[model samples]
Target chain A: MRLATFRGRDDESHVRRVGLVLGQGDHVRVHPFDAGFDLVELLAESAEWRDSQADVAAAGDGLALDEILLLPPVYPVAMRDFLTFEAHVDGMERGHGSPGVPDAWYDAPVFLFMAPHAVTGPYDDVAMPPDTERLDFELEVAAIVVRDVSDVTPQEARSAIGGYCVMNDWSARDVQGKEMSLKLGPSKGKDFATTIGPWVVTPDELEDCRDADGFLDLKMSVKVNGVEVGTDRSGNMGWSFEQLVSHASRASWVKAGEVLASGTCSTGSLAESWGRNGSLTPPPLQVGDVVEMTIERLGTIRNTVGPREESVAPVAPARRRSRLEASA
Target chain B: MRLATFRGRDDESHVRRVGLVLGQGDHVRVHPFDAGFDLVELLAESAEWRDSQADVAAAGDGLALDEILLLPPVYPVAMRDFLTFEAHVDGMERGHGSPGVPDAWYDAPVFLFMAPHAVTGPYDDVAMPPDTERLDFELEVAAIVVRDVSDVTPQEARSAIGGYCVMNDWSARDVQGKEMSLKLGPSKGKDFATTIGPWVVTPDELEDCRDADGFLDLKMSVKVNGVEVGTDRSGNMGWSFEQLVSHASRASWVKAGEVLASGTCSTGSLAESWGRNGSLTPPPLQVGDVVEMTIERLGTIRNTVGPREESVAPVAPARRRSRLEASA
Candidate 1:
């Protein structure tokens, strides 16, 4: 089952409704649930509830997919993205003139908390952040948590994922590098906007794509302005999704409606591509450029780069002073 | 005005209600609003609404403070903690064997997104993360946003704050150091729990404490098991709260009920004190130790360190592979 959140295209009230995607391509339709149904709430219920919803969806004739505007399937309660692709880390490190991936990278699956409010819709226009000149997009996939779990093993963690979706972890390379130099975050650098959806494809729909080790053998690709820039197999990830989720829950709760994203895959962004190839063939994104990313079975999300708005300048640095002078 | 969220001491329903704190010390009382009143929603309203609520509060008989259990003043929509204290940063770098603060530290107010779900009540027990041996508490103050604002100047951003509260950003030093070695986050290290509030003190209530430049001249201190270990002036911060808020909203929205923390003040944490003194005099926190942090005018929050829960081991690293081999 592919689930989505959408509002009727011509509806002035702008109320969001959950739906089950039916058919495909131009003939696709959406079986709308009750006006008050929420995907996040539904995902938190028992498996029997989901099956009941699927039964209800099968009975409806539904509305044409083109009649509605798709929003992100779930407005996550919490968001974390992990760098599980070793090739992407290698390229990023080399790009910064470092030797290669840090030995610490192999110690455990590491992740950073992201601003859940930064999420935007599948077909939305991503505003170019005022501070960046090197705007980029990351092609990835994300798993939506089905229920709350903590201190769980990899096997237990796997059961916590309800579905998956294509994700674009937008980036501002210039801003990110400067901020990360302090060893804290890529906070504002990646928090301006993140695109997810077209729809969430439930795990049951991808059973055939899972390998013996539980890695997804799905093709992932990204195209900018009709040009294919990168492609990689999801199975290339250094750590499996279950392992990443398990690591994330080691000391903290992975709550229902939270999103755990697979950080940029190999060649998933222009920065990595430039590092690997040693040339910026296709330069950083400019306003009006279109970015479209897709993961097999999950779906595609396409967004256009919008204009950067005028922003206030950051405060000037305070004059240096001794501890005694500061305390005085 | 002082605002808080609380529930009746014996109320098994556990319904949270917003209230205004009246009186002080042993004579303190809380004027509870209607059952449906939410502090987050109230903050998002106009000043007139706040004044009207205060009027209603003034007319109530109220409940004894000891008869209610206090919760965090607000369950933040988002949380960001900024390292704005130069003294703390200097001590931290020196402790890590670096000469002093990094040059990039002066560029702008650097912050990391924290897990909002980790927040607990002022007097709650903080769970020691399973993966760490060094548990610490950071003494800080946080401003809760009153309204949604974007691309605002420092002056404009200042008005977006509704009130301030004491914050304890709990940390796991061993885990944090290892994660920062990879330069992405202090994620799991600090996400287990954060404690905030006794109650939120409105800015108007602290006007007399403000210096000419708008920096708060408040005294902050921390104690462990009745032994005073750290003290610092809040005005020693290199970046003011307004500046931090402005920088945070450069290209993103700072919404109402979100929290912006003033990081750690000088000598706020055992780790910083150890860094400055070249000795772990008080040592890392033990499971039964009590931590009490106080900010002038804002109030105090006390938490006890609880035992760590057992967690699953992280997955072992996969065998090294070339990009071509992995992709194929």
Candidate 2:
């Protein structure tokens, strides 16, 4: 079963409804739910999310999905995106004179916090920040935390996942390099906007696709306009969701409704390709370009790149150097 | 005028109310306000927050300030803490082999986001995470963003501050040093909890104290069990709140109700003093210890260090190296 957030196109206010998405694209139906705004709360407060599956699935009382605007499934309490693929890590950092993935990456997953106010939905138009000359996209999968968890081993961490969704960890390469140098963040460089959705699907829904390594055997691909630019198998990650969740929970409490996102799949971002020696780069995403990614069972998430409003300007270098440049 | 968030003793729920605090210490009168949660909203939507100040000041309906449980003045939409004091930077990093004060601290202000969930009231218990062996406190002043800011000049940024609050940027030295080694965070090391309050004072209230440096000349002090350990003038910060906010607003929008925190004042924390040779290290905070910080104009924010619940345990090293240890 798929869960989604939607609001009638005519609604002037931001009141959105959580609902069950049933049927295929043209036949899609949405059954408005009373689960409040938090999906993790819905899943944790009662077993109905799992036990009343058939009741929510009965679509007679639902509205057509096309008549509503989709919002992010939930604006998370805390959101984290982990870097676990060795190739993506090596591909982005190797040319810069840094050693490939640190021994630590293999030991346990590492992730970073994301901006809370910048969440966008699958279909939203993401405006390219003026400072970012290299606007890029990262194809990823995200898991939503179902309950409070801490000090849980990989086995126990398994119960932490409520669902998975298509994610676009949109990035700005130039700004990212500058901020990462400051040794603190991929701050405003990454804080602009991150998109996730189509809808969130429970892990049980993909049980039939599990591979020997305990990851779903799913084909993931990214496209610029209509051409495929990157592809990978969802099962290829060096880290598993369970391990990532377990690692994150070891220190602080991983609260319910928090998001644990898989970092870019190998070759998932244009910056990696640009850093790949001798590779021909796609002209950086321009206004009006459509970017889309799809995973076998996870569904597709599509977005349009748009120009930031004229009033939005890059802070002048005269005022502040990326913390790294200043330190040097 | 001072604004605060509090809940009545009779309520079993966390039904906090925004209010005005009038008078001093024992004579303090609290007039519960209905102006909604976001102080920025209260300041931005109308001039009444400033213009009608006299009417609200009349003592007709109010409760004793001591009768209510005070919470963090506002739980902001986004929180940013800046590394503005060169001394604090030098003090925290010099021993780690990091060259003191990255030139960037002098050039432009840099800040990192804090977890929204971990914010607590001025007087709340700060549970020391078991993983943090050297828990420390940073005495800083925080500004609440009053309006949406993007690409604004430093002068405009000045108008963006809604009020000021005393901030305690609690840190875990072992965890922070480890994470910074990997070049990403200040995350889990700082994600635990940050204390702010007693109450927030609008800039209008501090007109008499504005210093030559543009910051209020507030004397800030920190104490453990009633013994003063550190003190500094908040005005000594090398970077002003205006510069920090302007620098932050340069690339992306700084939303209303977001927090812009000053990095610790010089010698504001135990760790900084520990780095100062011959200063006996204050034992790292343990459960039951009381830590308090008082700022001249902003009043005092006192908190007890509490033990994380027994069930709350740090993830085992077998799972993930504290990002710091591996990098070293």
What are the per-model C-alpha RMSD values against the true structure? 2.6, 5.5
User: Could you tell me which 10 consecutive residues in candidate 2 chain B have the lowest summed lDDT?
Assistant: B316-325
Q: Candidate 2 — what's its lDDT?
A: 0.75
* Model 2 agreement with the true structure over B52-83: per-residue lDDT tens digits: 75355444588885688888887776788777
Q: Candidate 1 chain B: worst 10 consecutive residues by lDDT?
A: B318-327
Residue A305 lDDT (model 2): 93
How far in Å is the alpha carbon of A130 misplaced in model 1? 0.9
- Give all TM-scores, in the order shown: 0.93, 0.83
What are the iRMS values of all candidates?
A: 2.1, 5.5
What local lDDT score does residue B22 receive in model 2, on the 0 to 100 scale? 80
CAPRI quality level assigned to candidate 1 from its DockQ score:
medium
Worst 10 residues of 1 chain A by lDDT: A318-327
